[model samples]
Target: MSTPAAPALDSLDLALLQALADHPRVGDLELSRLLSVARATVQGRLRRLGEAGVIRGWSPELSAAAAGFDVAAFVSLEIAQGALDTVRDELLAIPGVVEAFVTTGTSDVLCRIAAASHAGLQGVLLDLNRSTSVVRSTSVMVLSTLIEPRLLPLLATTAAGREARAPAYR
Candidate 1:
């Protein structure tokens, strides 16, 4: 079954979200201290937040450059009309594709690919061009990454606010 969508948050929920944003790995006790709430409250809220899918999970950020995947490319694809599903599925199956999204404007899909070298990127580009659903593609190599993945602002706060008034909790 699909997970239920998370509810919205209020101001205090926003505060908690901001606190977590500052330190995702902080313990409940530390979070309580930072938010000036009870430790039990923090624990309970965290549990609810996780169950509601507001807090997906936490992990340390790793550098691709350090890991030897120095080459990055943003590839824009023009998919044949009504073939987005086939194209998206194929893109997802590609080994080097780190992210993919359907988009409006000039391109039907945008994909982020990372590889250990330029040769690896070239192979990915060639494979994309050969895909049956892809009409054309443009790849722009990334010189550097200014920002990586992070949580959406106010996600936790919105969840907290909704939990506060949820009938089940009440």
Candidate 2:
């Protein structure tokens, strides 16, 4: 299915979003100064934008590698026809399966798994392959994560716009 079109944003909104992207924790006063808008206007815009669902709440990014989860691997799965549901459920139940996506490629499911060591990852891979519903799985261990950023460029723009609309409190 096609993605829904995003609402049009004015230049001011775009500027606000960009500013927020650069610094999510930036207060309304600072944002107001940066965007050259009144603090009250910034607060109002931010509230409106959030209510519209354009700006979701912020979250912190954690590093799995630094937190003792050194092993990272992508498991590509091919499940038996009519067994997709069962396979998906079983995979989700497995601990350390961080993310899973049902896709239209050679693999029916793509999963990102993290473990403390290579041995731990091996165990998970073996368990997946042994499942009757899973016809086959290809595991690719991550040697290194080259590009994983906390924020995307579009999000910065969106957040700035939303913050710009936050209500100004005297």
Superposed model 2: Cα runs more than 4 Å off? 1-5, 9-18, 40-54, 149-170
Error of 2 at 21 (Å): 3.9
lDDT score for residue 38 of model 1? 97
Clashing residue pairs in all predictions, respectively, total 3, 22
Q: Residue by residue across 10-122, what tens digits does model 2's lDDT show?
A: 56666777788788889999999999999998998888767666777777656787899899999999999999889878887888788889889898999999999999899
What is the lDDT of every predicted structure here?
Answer: 0.82, 0.82
Q: What is the lDDT of residue 85 in candidate 1?
A: 81
Off by over 4 Å in 1: 1-6, 149-170
Q: What is the TM-score of candidate 1?
A: 0.76
User: What is the lDDT for 156 in model 1?
Assistant: 54
